[model samples]
Target chain A: MKNLKIDETKYTPEMTFDPETLVIAIKGKSYPENTEEFYKPAFEWLEKNLSDLGKKGLTVNLELIYFNSSSSKALMNFFDMLEESVDNGDNITVNWMYEEDNESILEYGEEFLEDIETLPFNLVPLKSRE
Target chain B: MTDCIFELKNDLNKNGIFFCFSGPISQDLIVEIGDTLKNKMRLEDASKSSMRLVFSIIIEQAQNIIYYSEEKVRPWSAGVNAGSISVGIITVAKKDNSYIITSGNMIKTEHVDKLKEKIEKIKGMGKDELKQYYKSQRKKDPDEDSKGAGLGLIDIARKVSKPLEYNFSSIDETVSFFTVTTVVAEGL
Candidate 1:
């Protein structure tokens, strides 16, 4: 399947999915007016490609500076999909990256970490991006 | 009318409000407002976390207006297919070392009771409780009438330094004005 690439917008995050490497990177702020619409394509891509992923493993890196509540819900849905894939015996891991000083973002990551049942979710804090 | 402009400015200043906007609200406008507020807070040397809290509150409140506000206007040039923008007012102020964000918009009278009940329940929740509620709500599908995730108010409740404050006033038989305020303590 073709790779998925969405450029960042003022209110949306940059998202890139590499089918060959089975790595997906999402970075930047995400507060799109239509949260569902903004994430629909990625969700579709994952649905279409999940079977092909097999035992190859998938890595998702999420580095969000800020996201509004709706976007938060979208992220939860994204993780839910990943968890379902993991449940189906697909090898999947997620890395939630946040700035060390950003307590709120770190807290959010922690909450998601606590919620996941089986997926390997990591809260990786980077040094302050000064 | 021109003379009243000066009085209006003074009134806002006296109330500690540094930023205020009223009328049609769109997604693009929310981005501009968020950026301007972020820059202003950064200049004041506000901590990153405090800024994030304030910014998040503003986005939640502003987007609520965009989604649920009863008042709306569609630009004639945009044609019929273009969507209408909601009308509302949003303000940011400083008081007692806290940043205050207040937003008001018109809402259908039928929604007043349900909305009031929702806010009252959220206000009664402690931080931990709010966090749990937010997570639970995030897992559910948004209500049919909801334009965004139904978790916006709960998210605002969790980040706020204090309980959410809200009021409803009847505008007529069919609609009422609803206003909600959130506070973020500086130097968090």
Candidate 2:
């Protein structure tokens, strides 16, 4: 399958799903005009590549600055899909990256981890780039 | 006309309203007004988290109007999926070191009871409960007509420093005017 790379837009995030190194990164703000439509390609790519995952282990990085309620739901669905991979014996790790000073984002990361069973989830804080 | 315009400006200033929009609301307008809100908040020295909270609230409320407002206009477009714009009013104000977000729109009268029940539940929920509810709701499939995950109210509740406030007034036998407000305290 082809790697997925969607450049960031004003109201969406940059999504990079590479099957080669097994590093999936979704970064930037997310409040797309159509949440379901914006996330369609990512979902399709993951569904196609699920079988190829876990051999080398998969790392998912989420570095979102702001996301609307709709995008939040999309993230939950995406994580659910990854958790399913874990159930299939895939070695998957999810790193939720947030700025150090923003406690709200940190709390958000914790919230997303609530339903993630059996996946290696870590909340990683980065220093604010001033 | 000039005096009317001046009076309107004066009223907004008197109420500490920094931003206000009342008309057809679309995705493009949300992006445009959101940028203006951020620039204004930055100039006011809003903290990082506070800015995020304000922006999130604004977007959620605006989208609530966009998705649920009863008053709508179909706009001719070249895209495959035809679009409609909702009509509503959104205002951001400052009072007692707290920022307030207020949104108003019309809703079908039949939906008022259900909306009230949902709002009351959100109003009664503490932060932890709201967070749990938001997560659970996020997991559910969005309704067929829903443009969002149906977690907007809970998400707004989570950010607010107080219980969410709402008002509904009968506009006609078939529709009602609805308004919701959330406040973010100055400190966090």
Candidate 3:
């Protein structure tokens, strides 16, 4: 399958999925008005591609500066999907990146980490942006 | 009317309100408000975390208005296909070393009791309780009538430095005006 790329908007995150390397990166702020609509395409793509995963496994990186509550729910749903895939014996790991000084983001990452089971979810903190 | 503008400005300033917007609210407007507030707070040397909390509260409150406000109007001049926009008021203020966010919207009278009960329960929750509640609610599907995840209020409750404050005023037999306030300490 071809790679999926969505450029970031003022209120949406940049999302890119690479099939060859098995790395999916979602970065930036996400507070789209229609959270479900905004994430529908990515969900569809993952549904179609996750079942055909190779031994290399899939790496998902989520680096969000800020996201509203609805977007938070969407992220939860996204992670739930990944957890389901992991349960089905598909190799999947998630990296949740946040800035060191932004405790709110870190706390959010930690909450998600707590909810997730069986998925390798890591909270990677980047140094404060200059 | 023109002369009252100065009095209005003074009133807002006296109340510590630095930013205020009333009327139609849309997604694009939320982006602009969030960015502008971030920039304004940054200039004041507010910490990154505090700014994030303030911004998140505003987003949640404004979104609630966008989703459930009973007052709406289509910008007829924009075109027939133009979508209707929710009407509400949002304001950000600085007082006692805390940032105060207030949002007001019109809601159907039938929703008042349910909304009040929800906020009341959330207001009674402690920090740890709020966190647990948020996590549990996040896992569930939104209520049938909810347009967004039903977790917005709980999320707001978790970030706030104090319990959420809310009020409802009957506008008529069919509708009421609802307002909610969230406060975040600047240094926290």
Candidate 4:
């Protein structure tokens, strides 16, 4: 399957889904007016890609800058989807990346890991280039 | 009860309120208000950086009202919309020689539980811990959307000199008019 790329805006974030390696990256500030409307297409694409099994390993990277509470529930649903997919035999690795010194992002990673039993999550620290 | 709309000059002169607006809000409204607040705060010699922080919080909280407020009035346009959001008087008043900023808003009951949960958690955290948690939340997939968890309160807490304070009145079981008052310390 072909890769899907969604661009980010001042109020939203970018979404990337690839069939080549089964990896996805979402990065940006997401306080979208309509959370479901914005995420519907991406979720569909992910479902399709996961079903095809075109890639052996699945990795999801979240390097988000910001999001609203509505987006928080959506993130949980996304992880739930991943958890189920892994239970279905997909090898999923989720990496939550945070900039060094930004501890809020780290705790969020820990919180997301609380419910998942199927995926391997790595909370990686980002070294400041400054 | 306020007639709600007083002439800007008279209102300012009478109340000493630096800025105030009450009614419909959206992204457009937020941008417009942000521009004005940013300017006024800077002119008052409030640090530009901290002022930006306050402006962002105002936008988020106001947007919440625009989207979630149940209070409705007959609309000549834009259909039935959310309740009003007002940015009341913000003074650079001194407390023991330090400056503090105070802003307020009214929210709904359903929204109140959620806000309280989040706010309480934020209050429980240490500054460094809150910073890390916020960073970690940001690092998560943005596609995993939340109704209020994202940048709204986190940004407010990060920018504020201390934790936020809130009060509310139960209009009924289904609704509440919640108010959030946040302060910023300007070292004397």
Which residue runs of candidate 3 sit more than 4 Å off their true CA positions?
none
Candidate 2 wrongly placed segments (more than 4 Å):
B75-82, B143-145
Q: Mark the 10 consecutive residues where model 3 chain B has the least summed lDDT.
A: B74-83
Off by over 4 Å in 1: none
lDDT tens digits by residue: candidate 4, B1-188:
24544565575556444566566555566666666776766676865445545655666666666555665444455445643333232332334323344444445567677768888998888877876776567556443325444656775676677678777778887776766766656531
For model 1, residues A15-127, the per-residue Cα lDDT tens digits are 99998888999999999888999999999998898757736888899999999999989999988988888888989889999998888889889898888999899999899
- Writing each residue's lDDT as its tens digit, candidate 3 over B88-158 gives 99999999989999999999999999999999999888989989999998899989998988989999998
The lDDT, on a scale of 0 to 1, for candidate 4 is: 0.66
What tens-digit string does per-residue lDDT give for candidate 1 at B1-188? 98899999999999999999999999999999999999999999998889889888899899999999999999878988999999999999999989999999999999999999999999888888888899999999998989999989999888888788889999898999999989999977
State the TM-score of the second chain for every model: 0.97, 0.92, 0.97, 0.71
Residue-level lDDT tens digits of model 3 in A4-117: 999999989999999988999999999888899999999999888887762459999999999988899999999999889888888988999988888888999999999998
lDDT of 4 at A36: 71
Candidate order by TM-score, highest to lowest? 1, 3, 2, 4
Winner on DockQ (1 vs 4): 1
Residue A105 shift from truth in candidate 2, angstroms = 1.5
